[model samples]
Target: MCSGIRTNLHFPTCWDGKNLDSPDHQSHIAYPTAGPATFDTDGGACPSTHPVKIPQLMFEVVWDTTQFNDKNLWPEDGSQPFVFSMGDTTGYGQHGDYVFGWQGTALQTAMDNACFGATCKGLTTQTTATANKCSVPKTVNENEDGWITKLPGTEA
Candidate 1:
């Protein structure tokens, strides 16, 4: 029952292969056995414009916030706020495709807590300025704790 705002993430496909001088070379080179399969092919010689799949060593997550709030959360200046906790579980080669599939989960906390909070117990901090303005706990002693500590004998 987690709900706040939702968005889509896109990933660019890439290949891991050796730079070959010509396309005629098709000998199966011994690729790195540790990770995904790799081969030697002419650079940028793939016939199709679409991306080709290769050994997926890493992946990233990206998001667009344009229509997030209007979809689910309250409508504001298109600035929807929410906390996202994501991690990959499915190991490589789970899917038959050369690209590996990943399973992830995201939890939606309070809007204010997720959007403008300084410190969260189990969530990552997003904004330091918002945290400072909110007077959340400070990591350093020099930080003011929402109090004006003045000298007793100072001139009024």
Candidate 2:
């Protein structure tokens, strides 16, 4: 059986105090750096350049690869047998980026209230079924489902 894998991502929690966005999209935000141990472990202050403190966003994802543990599925060379959606086979190139989608001052209000979990003041919580009903316009027009011949752009 596959041992499975889990990945955790922490977003930048400091803002530039001016523009909401940067040209390349990530320059406006930075991670904390105060404690001596490490930048991420400290929960320290924002750098001088990015002084405005923002909510720290974190995501954790778990994958079940047990179905692929069969020896018949392994390549003769013994290389990895899985690939990420973006065509990353080695998995080291995995990265995440997203634009803030909170409505108006809703996010600000939550931050102001020091909200944790679903009990924050002035914040509304929804069940997973309700939240899953929401959808955004597709940025890329491509078929990303089913057992396709190959990943979207990885065809040789």
Instruction: Identify the leading candidate in terms of lDDT.
Output: 2
lDDT of 2 by residue, 15-74 (tens): 899988889888988887752223246468888998887766776566777766786667
> Pairing residues by index, what is the TM-score of model 2?
0.64
Candidate 2 Cα lDDT to native:
0.73
- Tens digit of lDDT per residue, candidate 1, span 1-156? 233233322222232344422253322222222323223322333323223433222232234444443444533564424433222222222222123233232233423244223444445555745644654566777742222223335555
Tell me each candidate's RMSD, in Å, in order.
Answer: 20.6, 4.7
Q: List the residue pairs that clash in candidate 1.
A: none
Q: State which candidate has the highest TM-score.
A: 2
Model 1 bad stretches (over 4 Å): 16-51, 55-156
